[model samples]
Target: MKNYRLERLSSQPIIQTADVQPFIEGYDVLGAFNPAACQFGDEILLLLRVAEAPKAEKGYIAIPIIEEQDGVPTLVVKKFKEPDGDYDPRVVTIDGKVYLTSISYLRIARSRDGVNFTIDAKPFLFPTRMDESYGVEDARITYLDGKYWITYTAVSEHGPGVGLAVTTDFVSVERVGMVLPPPNKDVALFPEKINGNYVLLHRPMVSDIGKPSVWLAESEDGIHWGNHRFLFGGRGLVDTKFEWEGGKIGAGPEPILTDEGWLVCYHGADPTHAYSLALALLDKNDPSIILDRSEAPLLTPELPWEREGFFPNVVFSNGWVRRPDGTIWVYYGAADSGVGLAKLIQE
Candidate 1:
C-alpha cells in the first residue's frame, strides 16, 4: 500500500452548488456531486448527480411533485407542510409515507486535465417514468462493446433500483429499463465480458435479513442478470470488523484491471454514518474470490469540505479513470455537496 500515493487535487470543491440551476423553479439548493468518470476521445467525462431542494420554511419541508401522465410520471417542484413525522436532510416521513427532501438528476461535465471540469447547463438524465419519479442518481459508466453502459440508481414510490442506459454519443441516450429490482443499487458493469458473460457488482439492501453488502451477478446480454453471489462487506464478516466499515459498504468505481487482479475501490460507513474509502483485490478469473483487502481505509474525511455539507463526513465515489502512465484519478463527492478529485500514482 505504501507504493500508492494519494494527492488531493484542490482545497476547494471542484463542482459547487452554485454552478447548476435547478430544473424546477423555487428550489433553493443545487447539490451537484457523486460523478461517474470515464475517458471519451482524449477527454475526461463525468456524469454528475445533481440534487435540488427547497429551503425548509418554519415547520415545513418541500417535497417534489410526482406528476403522472398516461401512466408515465415526472418530478416537479412542490411543497407540503411538515406533518407529524420524522424529517431529515435526505428524506421525510409523514403519515407513514416517505418523501425525498430533494429531487436528483444526472448532468454532464467534461475536462481535459481531470481536475478542471466544465459542467453543462442542462441536465443529461431526468425522471421521465413512474419508476424514477423521485429521480435518477449516482451513475457508473463503463465503456463496453463500443458503447458506454450507464448503470444508475432510480428512486420512486416503488423503491430504489438499478436502471440501465446506453450511449455512443452523449448527445442521445437509449434507456435499457430497470435491470435490477427495488432495494438494490450501486451497480457497476465490467468493461468487457467475463467468460462469455457480462459481470455486474451491486449492493442489495435486505434490512430484515441482513445489512447491505456487495454482490455479483451474471448476465448473458447485459440486460437480464442472475446467478447472484455474495462478494463482501456485511455484519459478522471478518473483513468488515474495521470500525469505519462495520455498518455498511458498497462498490465504488468500476474495478480496475491490473496484472495482479481486479482492483476495486469501495465506500464504507460505520454505525455513526461516517463514510470512508477502502480497497480490495479480486481474482481476475473468478471475481467472486477475494484476493486482498485493506485493513484500514484508503481515504477518510479529514478536510473541512469532506466533513460538512448535505451529508456530513462522507466521501463517496462512483467513478475513476486510470491514465496510461499508471496514474489513477478518482472523482468523488465530498460531504455530498461537491465533487473532488484525488490522484493515486503507483510507486
Candidate 2:
C-alpha cells in the first residue's frame, strides 16, 4: 500500500478566543477547534465547535449552566469552589457529577482553496434547548438527498448525547431533536441508505465497565435507530497489541463511498490519552462487515502546535472534503485549541 502525502496548512489557530470575545462575555476564553466540513457552492464550509469558559481564578472555577426562559435558552454562570471540584482543563468533576469547564457553540467558516478560511463572527448554532444547555460540539455534516444533515454532540447536565439538525442553505436550520441517548457520541451518518435503511456509526462510552468502540445501527427514517451491532471493537485477542487505538476509538467524518468499499477515517487514542487518526474500509453492501483497516495511525501529534495547548497531544477531526482531482483535504483540531489542515493525495 502506498502512503498519502500529508501537508500542514497553518501553524497558528485559525479561530481564537479573541475572535469570539465580542459575541460572548469579555471574561470568556475561546478554544475554537474540531470543525465539520462540506462543499457548498464554490466554497468549503466548516462548522466549528467553539468552546468558551470564564476566566479562571485560583480558588474557584466558573461553569456555564443552561436554563429555558420563555422558550429561549439562557446561560447562567455558576462558580464551583476549587476544593469541591477536580479540574483537568476540559472537564470538572465534583461529587460524582461531571461538568465541562467550557460551554460550546457551533460557528461557521468558509474557504475557497480549502486552506485559507474566513470564520463568521456570529455563531451558527447555540444552546437553545435544555438538552444542549452545555452546548453543541464536534459536528459531523453529511449532505444527502439535497439537504445537509448535521449530527453533533449535545452536552448537558444529564450527559453527552447525539443531536441532529438539517439545513439546505445554511442560513436557516431545522432542529431534529436528540437521536441517540446520553453516554454516546462520535456519530457519523452514511450519505446514502444501505438496503433501504440508513446506517450510522457511533461510540457509546460506559466509563470503566466497557471499552469505548465504534458501533453500527440502522434506521428507516434516520431518527429512530435499531438493529444495533458491534462493528469495530479496538480490544480483543487479535487487537490486544495495538495500543494506539486500544484505549478508545470513534468514527470521524462521513464515510466516503468508493469503488473499494466505504472509506472511513477514524480517531483513536492510547491509554495515555494520545490521539491519532487511522483508516478503515467496510463492505459497501454491508457496512457492518469490515474489509480492511490500518494497523497504525495515518496521522498523529508531530508538531509543536499539535502537542501543546488546552488538550495536549490531540489531533482530532470531524470533517473532511474530497476534491474533484482526488485530493482529500482533512481539517482537524490540534491540541483542542486551534484548527489545522492536511491534504492527502493518493500516490
Candidate 3:
C-alpha cells in the first residue's frame, strides 16, 4: 500500500475561540476544537468541544465546575490561593487534588462549504450528571443503524471515561449513559456492524505494568461491549528512551472502511505530550488484525496556531468526513484552541 499524505487547507483554523462566546456570563471561551464532523444533508455539522473557564481574579486561580444545586446542575467556580504545591498552565494542584484550568462542553456548528461555521448560542451538551461534572470532551460521531451515535469523554474526579449519546436530527439527543468506565477514552465506533456485531476502537491507559495502547471491542447491541483485545502498543511503554507517541496514543476518528482496509487516524504523543497524527490499516473483517501502519506521522504541529495555545504542540482529531469523490477531510484541534482542516485522497 502507498502512503497517504495530508493536504492541509489553505484557509486553516476554520474555527477559533475568538469566533465563539462563553456559555455563561462570567466565563471566558478558552478553546473551540476537537470537533466531531458529519455530513448532514447538504451541509456539514461539527460537534465542537468548547472549553471555558471563569475569569480569574488577581492572586487567585479559579476552576469552573458543575454541581447539582437543588437537583439542577449549576455551573460554579472554585477559587484557590496561589498553590503552594505545583501548578501548570493547564492544571493546578491544590492541596492534594488536581483540577483542570477549564471546563468543556459540546457545541454544534454548521457550515455550507465546511470552512466558515455558525456556532450555536448555547451548549449542545454539558455536565448534567455527576460523572460529567468536570466536562465532556473530544466527541466522535458515527452514523450507524439510522442514528448518529456520539462517543465522548466524560471527565470528573474519577478520570476520563467513554460516554454515549445518540441523535437523529442533531436536535434532540438521547443520553445513553457511560458505556466504558474510567481510565479509558478516545472511543470511536465503526461506521457499520461487522458480522452482526458492532465494533469500536478505544484507548485504555496504563500506569503500573503495561503501556497505554489502542484496543478493539465488539458488542451485540452497540452498548454492552466485550471481547476486549489489545490492538497495538506504542513506543514508550517500558523503555527509558523517548520517541514519537511514546508518552501515550489514542484513537482519533471513526475507522473508515476502504478498498485497502479500515483506515484509522490516531494521535500519538511523546514524553513531552507533543501530539501528532498517524495512520493505520486494520483487517476488514476482523479489525483486531493490523494490516499496515504509517512509519512517520502524516500530520504534525507546525503552523503558528498549531504550535501555540492552551496546549502547545498538539494536533488532535476526533472527526473526519469522506466525500463522494473519495476525498477525506480531516478536522482536527489545533493546540487545543482552534479547528483546522486537512485533505487526503486515498489512492
Candidate 4:
C-alpha cells in the first residue's frame, strides 16, 4: 500500500503572535491558520489567519472586529450579550483573566523564505456591510487569468458563509461580495477554469444535512456560485466507527492540474474537532467528480505541539504550491496555533 508522509517544513511559524501585535490583539492571536502562499513576480505571498479578542470593560464584552466604515480595518468595543449578538465563537470570562472564545477576522502578510513574514500595515480584507458582521476567516487564494480570486469565510450572528474578492496588484481589493449562502465554509477553487467555467469545492454544515460532508459548486464569472452537488462524503470505517465525516472537510489549496488529475488537499475533522489533512485526486476535465481519495489520513496530529494548543489535535490547511517538476509544498496551521508545511509526492 502507498503511504503519504507528513514531513515538517519549517520550525518557525510564518505568521506568529510576536510579529502580529499592536496591529491586532495578542490574547487570542492565532494567525496563519489557512495561509494562502503563492509566487508572484519572484516573491511568495502568504495570506495569514488573524484573530483578535473583544476588548473587555468592567463587565461588558468588547467584541473585536474590522469596523465597517471606510473599510480601513479598526476595532469596535461592543457589549457581548446584544440581542443580535455575534455567533462565530463565544468570548466569556471564567474567573478573572480574559480569554478569546471566538475571534474571527481576515489577516494578511507577505514572505520571502515562506517562513519569515511581514504583516500588512492594516488588514488586507476586513468586514464590510455584507455577511461579515460576525467576522471573517480562512482565505484560499488562486491566481488565474491575470487576476487573484480569494475565497473566504463570512461569519455573522446567523451562521458562517463564503465570500469572494478579486484583485490584480494584491494591494487594492475589489469585493465581489458573499458568493456562498449560510452555514458553509472551507471553499477551494480550481486554480484555472474547468470546462470554461469556474469549479469550486465547498462544504455546507447542517446538524441535519447528513453530517458535515464535502460538496461541489460551480461559478461562471467567479462571483455568484450555485448548482450544488455532492463531491464526496465521509465514509464509515472500522477504525472510525463506521461514521461519515466527523465534523467537516473541504478543498485545502487551489487545485493543481496534474497529469493524472487535479491534486486536492483537504481537511477532515471528527466530532472532537481534531483536524487531519487528506488528499483526493480529481478529474482535470471535470474536477467536481472525484477520481480517487485516500482511505487514511495523509497528515494527522501526531506531534506534541500539534496535539496541544489553543484548540488541540488540529492540522488544517487552505493553501499550497506545486512546482513545474511536480514537487508540491503544502502549508497548514498546527493546532490552530501557527503555520507549518509538508511535501507532496505523486510518484
Best by lDDT: 3
| Candidate closer to the true structure by TM-score (higher is better), 1 or 3 | 3
- Predicted candidate 4, C-alpha RMSD: 4.7
Estimated TM-score per prediction?
Answer: 0.94, 0.93, 0.96, 0.85
**Weakest 10 consecutive residues, lDDT, candidate 1?**
233-242
Question: What TM-score should be assigned to candidate 3?
Answer: 0.96
- lDDT, each prediction: 0.85, 0.85, 0.89, 0.71
Better of 1 and 4 by TM-score: 1
Give the C-alpha lDDT of model 3: 0.89
Write candidate 2's Cα lDDT for 270-347 as tens digits.
Answer: 888889888888999999889888767788898887898888899898899988787788999888888888876556
Which has the higher lDDT value, candidate number 1 or candidate number 3? Answer: 3
- Model 3 C-alpha lDDT per residue in residues 1-347, reported as the tens digit of each score: 25688889855698988999898788899999999999999889999999988887988898888788899878788888876655585777778887888999999999989888999999888888888989999999999999999999999888999999999998889999999999899999999999889999999878878878999999999999999999987866555443777878889999999887899999889988899998999999888889998777788899999999988999999999987677999999999899999997554
- Candidate achieving the largest TM-score: 3
Clashes of 4: 2
What stretches of model 4 exceed 4 Å from their correct place? Answer: 1-4, 24-32, 55-60, 65-75, 80-102, 237-245
Which is the winner by TM-score between candidate 1 and candidate 2? 1
Model 3: how far residue 19 lies from native, Å:
0.5
